[model samples]
Target: MQDRSTFHDAATPLPEVAGYRVLRRIADGGMSTVYLARQESLGRDVAIKVMRPEALGDEVSRRRFENEARTIGRLDHPHIVGIHQIGRTADDRPFFVMPHMTRGHLGQRDLAGDEARIREILRALLSALAYAHARGVIHRDVKAENVLFDDADRPLLADFGIALRRGYGSRVTSAGLALGSTAYMAPEQARGEEVDHRADLYAMGVLTWEMLTGRLPFEAQDALSMAVMHAQDPIPRLPPHLRHWQKFIDRSMAKYPLKRHHDAADMLQALERIPYGPQRSFSPRDAAAAGVARMRDLPRGAWIVLGLILAAGLGFGLRHGDDTARGFFRASQPQPAADSMAVGGAAVIDNPDDALLRAAPESEASTLVEDARRQLEQRRLVSPSDDNAYDSLVAVARIAPDHLELPQLSAQLARALATDAVRATKNGDDADARARFERIATLVQATGLADDDLARELRRDTTAALAVRIDAAARRFDREAARKAAALAGVANLDADALGRLRRQAEAIPAVGAVLPGDPARMTVVRSGDGAYALTRRHISRSEYARFAEATGRPATLCRERASVLRVIARRDWTDPGFEQNNADPVVCVSWDDAQAFAQWLGARNGHRYRLPTTVEASGSAAAVGSRAVAEWLLDCEGDCVRRKVRGSSWRRDEDSRARDGGRGYDDVGFRLVREP
Candidate 1:
């Protein structure tokens, strides 16, 4: 609808309203004219919303308008736009002052993967809804238009003119006196029944859906049909890209009030879990204060139209992250330790020995890499649902003996490499471990892993991370010229704090005590004599020792079993899939908690003794002793600091590494393994 025009000829600009000077019109909304005005005494800008003169002449319309102002005035919520002062013109026309907002609404022009912007918007809206619902105030008209963004880009819900408080339902206009838009109206409101906070949730669901998908769920030709769909229509499914957000969106749009999110607090928690992007700090109360100012000043029609444009723009522009623009849809447990292993993205090597033995010849590996390239080219022809092609390439990397043909591998290889590194560490192998760790740094620098800006930055930062690892290993072990070698390898000191910590840790280990066999750097192999020797050539385990101990104690046969958890660890001579068996990394799938539990179980099974997953730094330090046999593809704590990622691999994919990259990038990919702890 076109905005109402200002009546310039009606009267000369008024000097002040209750000590405020009238300025030019800033916005106009339905039933109100919002003007940008100034409080001379307070030296502040404020928005003054005035009742339409026509409505003022009608006792009923005037009373209804005044009631809205009074209802909003009584509310004090961070999310709900607040009221500062209320006054009347010489003719008794109601005017109210609220804080003035400078930032525009969420319009097509502002939506993008800007972490800060989206966070502000979500926080303000959610906070407002939460506060309003808690105090028995049900904002029947919750929509993008009704939400105002302030200078900080945080949201503030305005236009509570149509709010209905519980126990004051009688004050609400009777049936057929429709309020709120059909596009965002709740089912109860559409049915003309008693409405409550659920109505606001429905509106939020619609708003969030629009933010994600750039469209509404129902596209009816009339208001009645829309209402029908809202009340009884099946929950519409968003695009495949948005399926991951199903639970959040579905609950937000539940048919029953009780079925919807209990409140804004609950909904906001869900929003945080969805992993859109980095978040921006914002304050909703500040924005609401601004909206109040605008409402009190501009002409009603103009303000309404401006608000509509801002809302529409916001809905159109908002997206999850800077990666591929997947369609939007209507959108968390607890505090976990920073050091805990995340099993979402890592690979599991079930038989490290078998994997090493199965490594493919160089020629075969090359051909397999070729085939993977061909398959990637046909991704458009392949079902978007199928992610097998990517996995095949990863499998090739696992079986390759020399880890050659790195360029021909898929992005999945990055994950596989890390998985291999971790596995190698578990078995106490170190050479293969260092190679894989360095390989990851190189991959980030040269590969197409830079699909998104955030990922690219992360990859770049990872390069610096690798250098620090090399230096720490040398200092702790007292290895000669290690720091010089690191510099020669093109690794610079990127993080000062990390380097210092590594130095401190190295000093604590006290250069392997003399005559302690492997404690001495030069005689490390001395400890490998007799029963301690486990060959890299044979993927076999020495179950004899455990068996003998069990027999002496008369334990069960299974109790005597202590086979190598990772039967094999292999890297392809070239990138290829048939090489997966040859490659030998067992794609282990489990949560960080699950992995830790398994490690604990293993320790308990071994007579209450505990084993710990080696930190990435430790595994790298021992690379020389371990690299000859298995590569540690999945060690933790190497990078030192915890950094966040945009996309995570899925748990289902981890069960079978290939599936993890399915549909698109996933953030859950940081999956890791646990040692007997």
Candidate 2:
């Protein structure tokens, strides 16, 4: 239906509405005013969301809003922002009451605080979504603004004004067809196609991308261009730090609804798998909810033992040092590996053109160039008094870490050195600029720098610059000498004959000699173990041509070991959507019993003896690296007394049994590899 509109000219003072006293306006949206209101009937404070008079007065839209109000009131969930009451005003405008959440949205908080906080927030959001989907409610609009916080700051999905049931929107027009922000809208939604809960997932994908990168995945000059990009353009790959989150976005923002997550609950569960920062059981409702379900199968003694173990682990982890305190502020600074800012005061680059130029198109080389420059600049400007200074230093440092004086100092130095060399060559004062270039190269290499292309360009530019200083008579000789020296300096300056010979020799060898599937390239040493099984070790091997003569041949082959290591044994938790794909890669969604049976079948297929599930310690450290990434389906044996069981995966937990399922099967994001040896 009709879009929401804000009341800019309404002069009436809203003293009371639907028996609730308005305190103040908490938020003003395009179509509604959210106020902190206190209910006179129950003497309780609640957030009263009121529609604009224009929207309420519209007959068709008002009926739809009333219907939505009833639908939202029936939904009961801990993760969902609860609805208290719905009523019409004296003037006949529909309004709804909800818990007065004072803390605000998760996006407004410091994300770098602790891993557990992030985890808790994600868990709560997902849990609420799961609850809503189970009841056939589609939020259709899940954005940061629609999410609010309880008194403790835990996330609660709010504002279902535009929500729809499975089939309610056909006569009313598609809910998201003409709605949602350009950057947050799903590709399907952007195209005005028939939408589903997957649209919410897509919005969440955009939100998560923003959360990790402090930037939107897609951008355009206008909404129309952005919509076009969403409809036709590919979703930008996440920055390095957010690579782990790709699977979530991939499933959430699949081109088609069928290709996206099965439902909100599935996406929420998958979110729990990602490692973020510190968490606490701050929400009493969440704590109560998770506890009741988990306690169903455990006996008194088992529960006691589990509690003791948890207490012991917590004590141990915190007794010596609190995890949050140890690295909270320190890790708040973005490390070399991460591309985003961890601190709030860091200067944000809003200019898109400069960013595009710095990054170029997506490629391994270009990514490295961008990353190296960014990292070097950040490293150089380790200390800055203000955000702008820090930001400026970073920009310059990326291009040249050595020259970190003024704004664009590196570019200035590089240009100055080049110009001086050119003048020296023109006037026959040949030494200075060449010496400077050489000094730059030495500094770069000594600092363990690795931008090979940049280094080569600098050398060539310096040589050309040198040419400008030499007299006419010696110019040709200087140019020739420069070219020859540049060629010999490990740059790609070989003749065609030599290149041809190298190519011919390389073509003779098979590209994959002793290569293993789903693994890296390296030399494999097959050795017989005492258990009468074959074990492989990675190693390097030289080609026969190189060994026989000093002639260039094929590239050396690497043999990676075929054997898999066991990660850990985890109990089956619940199903998660691996995203939608009309392909056979869809993982089998099974329960704990199903997983154990599958493990038995797998072992039987490999050999007669049953392969036992591993312990937490056994699956941890270097040992777990040999196991699987997806651990649920491959887990062996069930622990009868407790939820604790063995599976193939990494566990940040100590004695606590982690859960795994096949919901993430289609994901190459992370999984386990099995090997007998």
Candidate 3:
């Protein structure tokens, strides 16, 4: 593909391309023109890249355009722009549709001074390339312009198939091969020799070089001269002040493909080694880690002395309260309790380095460490925002630095914190959620999860959660709530309607049928009798129970008094009887108390008051309609509320007789409503 392509004027009405209606020209490459088009069926905008009318006759360009579609169609990856549909225009031009990326390409994005974003873009590019390569497809052009971001700023590799151009010269260096962009091409690629995935790595190096220093790695007057420079020139060196990037750049762009990192995975390892931030963590070369490795060779007495020194340093350094600890200690020095974050009795040291931690890794310590980790896991799950759990885990680390479970535990805790953070944000506890995420950021090292992947998810979720809250606040016209929501979101996603959609879905109360209307002032009167108040027609159904459970954020469980581990009657829900249940059947298994709670909740939602039927009301209803199946609840018969008096025969009784019982529960047991007006 050429560095640039020309298309019809922006104001010119674009010709219809297949099923998509071209809205406007979005991009142009040497061989094709990309236009924003509306997918009528899907009701979304897509990018449709079609071969330029002039290039339709060129077989190479035709083949390349088709190949690009085939290449993208063959792979499915999060970082790669996906092909939506492929077709030919009325003018016989091949074109394919991809999800439109409005955030533009990385080359066009102003990512200056944003190291985190640059690293993220590189990671996305390399991962996409690696995936394509593993499947025998090479991304020959890996320049920043080929990388684009979605609405959430997630980078995607675009223009996959359109770059590999063949038959550039009869002076093939070795055999039939293709060349891509000249400035970013590898030596072999520039030489028009056979190339492989390694060429993509070279291109990425050039892209990275531009990202860090805002210039191409190798500058030349013309494409021909640049290709020559790439083939024979010394790999461009990053300036002395940019030395930290020298190793990554030089190795990736090495003249010899074999001299570069073997693959994307190796490159990722090198990238991970670079310090993305401050001394937030210890790396392999950190003095403490090296000293620990050396401690394995030290004598026992030396180890004891070192341990004491570490203890002393910890005591003097970690005087601040709470989970904020800046030191280490030994096991014999009395560590904090498993549940507590405050390190109280451990012997402190003046220098942590003196702890030449020499002692064969013992299973006893391992067992204790594992036990503490299990407790930590429990704490993380039940109360992830609890700083004490983090403090406790750190205490375990100080005592047993070499414990095998530390990494796994750290990762689990970080994941739990992230999950909790997202949950809190969704629940509108923005402050708590933000705090948890900040805490999670400090512990990403423990789990070995990719820092980028976790951070991206956290940020995305936080933004969405806040967006949800913003729409909700706007609906209520609460300016303070809106302001707080906006602050948490950092920047609002005005296009977001995720919250409004949920409001529509959640606000619908449970559907109840056959309501006997009463005065709107107090409550609905289902039935009026001499015994007490009013009664409802049918019994409460499973659907009502489910709605109550969901609205109250409470799980419905069978009454524990009658439920047993040995018996199969109760497994989960109050309505589910561990067998096939009729949705219309009166809800069963819930105790009188549970029933009362549901009544209270339903009444609150409906703006009324409800409670258990009085004994008089129950008997009067049975007498009024005659006995029927489905034994129902009545107010406590006697002084003891442990057993409720139930009136009417059950479904199995087959008798129209009015009878009352004070037993616990029956399979045919159910309840009906009696209301007040």
Listed in order, each prediction's TM-score against the native is: 0.40, 0.39, 0.41
Q: What C-alpha lDDT, on a 0 to 100 scale, does residue 491 get in candidate 3?
A: 30
Stretches of candidate 2 exceeding 4 Å from the true structure = 1-10, 112-115, 171-177, 272-677
lDDT of prediction 3: 0.64
lDDT of 1: 0.51
For 1-677, candidate 1 gives per-residue lDDT tens digits of: 11333544446444246667787776666666788788775578877888766666666556556767877766655555666667786656688878776665554334433444555577678777776788777778876667776665567788776777767763444335657788888787887777777788878888877776667777799998988898899888877666645677899988888999888776775664453433333489878988898778989899789999998877766653432233122111222455244477764444343334454666755766666666656642122434434444545555663445544354555555555554543333456656656665655554434334333333333333333344344333432223433332233222455345444444443233222122211222111111111111211111322232332232221110113343234221112211232223321212233223333333322222222223332222232211122222232322332322112223223222222211111212222222111
Give per-residue CA lDDT, model 3, range 144-237, as digits (tens). Answer: 7778788988988877754343433222222354456788888888777777778888888888888887878779899889888887888777
Show where candidate 1 strays beyond 4 Å.
1-16, 57-60, 107-109, 112-116, 174-176, 275-677
| lDDT tens readout by residue for model 2, 1-677 | 11222343346667357567777666765556777777775577877777778775666566566656766665655567655556666666667777777776655655642545555666567667766777777776776666777776667787776676765764363444556677788777777766676777788877776666666788899998988887787778876655666777777767777877777655654664453322232598888888998888688899899999999988887866664455543324322434444368774444333343353456443343444356345542222333322334344345545542332333433344445544554454445545545544443343334543344444444333322222121212223333333332222233344334333333322221222232221212122221111111210011211221122111222111122242122222112222332222212222334333333333322222222234432243222222223332234334453343434332222332444332222121122223332
Query: For model 3, where is the 10-residue window of minimal lDDT?
Result: 523-532
- Candidate 2 lDDT at 664 equals 23
Q: Model 2: which ten-residue window has the lowest total lDDT?
A: 533-542
Ranking by TM-score: 3, 1, 2
